[model samples]
Target: MTEVLVVGAGPVGLALAADLRMRGVEVAVVERRTDPGAGTRAIGIHSPALALLEASGATDGIRERAVRIARGEARADGRVLAEIRFDRLRARHPYVAALPQSDTIEVLTALAPPVRRGVGVTSLRQETDGIRAQLDDGGEIRAGVVVVATGWSGRDLVYRPGAVRTHHYPDRYVMADVVASGGPVARVHLERAGVVESFPLPGGRRRLVAWAGTNEVTDADGFLRDAVAARTGTPVDIAGASTFGVRRAVAPALRRGRVIVVGDAAHEVSPIGGQGMNLGLLDALTLAPLLGPWVRRGDDAGLARWERDRLASARHAARLAFLNTMLGRAAGPSAHAARTMALRTALRGPGGEAFTRAYAMRFDRAARARG
Candidate 1:
């Protein structure tokens, strides 16, 4: 029997397998996709995650292709309200590393074992000494432990009574990646209409995200361009755009019998603050260390504690995402002014550094202590 069978070959699963391989643990990876993806999807790797990924030698590769965002600016009506400098953080990786999800997967894939492609786990059944996983390929694999690292959509494969809870927010946004020159600073425009955000990308490209109220938009590019030009006075000629809604999901228990869950399959948060992937990556990092002992010596003392700590981390990330979406929501002129003043006060001096640290997801207990 395999010691550990990891489902889903996404960033989280790949990361977990890589960490396990580094520790000399017997790990197998499976993915539903026949071929690797090519798009630059999720784009932020924070300090905490970077520290955790150092063991797998992924941090250096990610930094090579990523744009380091060391500063964040909050503006309104063409005026700067406040700024958060990540460089002030007392950590090894102070900046939030921005790389395409595709690039991240490539970096991790090189470190993990060969993944079995075009196969999917249909269901999982807990056994006395192991878990039996039913695969779509008409075969079953029994492993000492199984880890479900699939994303949010793969929740169905491991469904149990009261396993997961989900909630969707009414917020909507239009975002797009374009070839433009925006310096390596992340800028947010808190306007009366809504919020307009811009982040620098590699190869002279930039990403723009603008709030679009409750109603859906058909012409995402036009709406985004208008929102940016009207609110931030910056005209953007985008080739295309996409719209998405935010949601949060959490599993109170990450493990059921011998089968465990990690990554988005275990918890999912809004992408407003770019915390979802980092949270999952940290999950893999923390779980990898514990899985080694459990699988090798049957020492499961840390499993319960790991679950509790990871649950708390997920809740904290959800709260942060909620705050991010709320702060960027549309407001009246009076509310906008009040919010601007509040931001200025909150992001000033020492508070700004603290905010930057938290935004970079340094509060997770498993993260390395800052020097």
Candidate 2:
């Protein structure tokens, strides 16, 4: 039996596998994708998340590939609502960095020992000794533990037996690419018409996620022309585009006997704070220290402990996401006015500084990992 079997080759799966191997646990990563990769997807390496990456000793190269977003500003009608000065966050890295998830998955996956691609786990059954995973072709894997880091639809289908929150909104969040003509880092500009967020890419291209203006990628050439003209004040080419339904969800239990779920498989954070991936990475990192010894020593109690420890953290992330998405969809006159006032208050004196620290995710004395 393998020490651990990791499902999915996404950021969280790759990260969990790498961390386990680094700690001397034998691991096998199973990814059904013929070739797993993402394009123009999430890569906001927030400070707190970056600190976790640093601990893994795998962040330096990824850091170099990312553009430092030392501040995050929100604007409406081109008027500033809130600007978070990340320099004040209490950490060595006090800012957000933008790197595509594709690059992130590649970097983290390459760090793992190896991957079992093309093979898929169809169902999970807990046994007295370990857990049995039935694969697509009726093959099976018995492992001391399991890690589920699968993405949206897959997790929804696989983890339905667990606590499931099917939260969907009619508000379609359109994400596409556009050239950055302004400053570096990242910016979120909101107008009565819509919201537009721009992030710098490791490559020359600048990525834009917008909810307003003419939707592009609906038609490649036409979308490119429309999106480019909208963002850079000139027509631009389409690098990539994808639309997804984002929401909050948590597996009923972080663990069921020897079977375990972490990352998006356990819970999903909405895209508002860009915390989904960040929180998922934290899940992997946090589990390593807490569960490593158990996997190494082959102790069932250790596996049990991992389940209990991961529950609270996953739940908090899911709830926070639910609230953020709820607020992001509301842009009525009153909500906008209230938001403006709140931003102004949070930007002044000590309040602003405190808010900035929180925004940067530098929660002082707050333990982000398992105790």
- Judged by lDDT, which candidate is best? 1
Q: Which candidate number maximizes TM-score?
A: 1
Task: For residues 178-247, write the lDDT of model 2, one tens digit per residue.
Answer: 5545566566665433455666676566776555332323554454446435643545565556555566
User: Ten-residue segment with the worst summed lDDT in candidate 2?
Assistant: 362-371
Where does candidate 1 clash, by residue pair?
Answer: none
Off-target runs (Cα >4 Å) in candidate 2 are 153-162, 212-240, 296-311, 330-335, 349-351, 363-371
Measured on C-alpha atoms, candidate 2 has an lDDT of: 0.67
> Candidate 1 — which residues are off by over 4 angstroms?
161-163, 368-371
Query: All candidates: CA RMSD in angstroms?
Result: 1.4, 3.6
In the range 1-371, model 1's lDDT, one tens digit per residue, is: 88999999999999999999999989999898998788776898888889889999998999999999999898887888788788888788889898788999999999999999999989888887888999999998889899999887677767765568788899899999988777899998889998888888888888889989999998998898888889988787976689999988888788878888888898889888888998998888888988878977899999998899889999999999999999989998889889988888888866787778788888876665421
Please report how far candidate 1 places residue 353 from its true position, in Å: 2.3
The alpha-carbon root-mean-square deviation between model 1 and the true structure, to one decimal in Å, is 1.4
